[model samples]
Target: MDRRVYGAEPSERDPGPKPGRAYVELVGGPLDGMLLDVTGWPPQEVVDGAVLMSEHGAFGPGGRSGYEPAEAVAGAGGVGRFVWRGDVP
Candidate 1:
């Protein structure tokens, strides 16, 4: 096995518009492919936040305005004008 030295990615060192935080879109059930931009600092905060929101009915009935929670499915990759809290361009 060849061991690769880890430091910074090649593109990162180039300083050409460094990428922002690593965020994952919430796909599948009750998410409806919403881009829930989360901070990577706390690690599992993304999933935890999702579950929390779900529990708090954020992804349930009346959680999202206009959009119905019943439409949310897993891995759908569905796109819309406005997701949860962010506006899509």
Candidate 2:
């Protein structure tokens, strides 16, 4: 498996393996206490997604989203929810 982690502009990171489903809550940022519904994605991806959300956020291309799974969730055959939390820098 390709374990060369990168985030926030091609920088290397090591969040280890994070399999299955869980929620990654953001802390001390604009999006604090926001639960990211991560399904079958590694923990690094979740954190990176949250970070990108916090950094760029809304109506823009978020670069370098790490560790995305093959299957697509959110607005599929089942119900899905979307939440946004962030502050203008």
Candidate 3:
């Protein structure tokens, strides 16, 4: 795997992957271009999707980003994709 940090500050923001941690790519929506850590995620949570919070969002911050699992995309390493559902205030 390439495993290169893409955007923001890895240590302070994305934090990509650590020794035992894993992450999924967030596609579209306010939290687009972000990586979500799913290292110890429950099997059901990965399947059912997740609602992530963003301090900096489309509406200027402090909103929830809804995402659902989608088919894996190339370069995403079969880690799956999180397609945007919507944002909640």
lDDT of each: 0.33, 0.36, 0.67
Against the hidden true structure, what lDDT does model 1 obtain? 0.33
Q: All candidates' TM-scores?
A: 0.30, 0.30, 0.67
Task: Report the C-alpha displacement of residue 45, candidate 3, in angstroms.
Answer: 0.7
Clashing residue pairs in candidate 3, if any? Answer: none
lDDT of 2 by residue, 1-89 (tens): 43221122344363332344354433333343333445565544543443344344333444311222223333222222223334332
Candidate 1 deviant stretches above 4 angstroms: 1-19, 47-49, 52-89
TM-score of 3: 0.67
The superposed Cα distance between candidate 1 and the true structure at residue 33, in angstroms, equals: 1.3
Alpha-carbon deviation at 14 in model 2, angstroms: 34
Worst 10 residues of 3 by lDDT: 1-10
Off by over 4 Å in 3: 1-14, 56-59, 72-78
Sort order, lDDT high to low? 3, 2, 1
Candidate 3 local lDDT, 49-73, one digit each (tens): 7887766665556677789888643
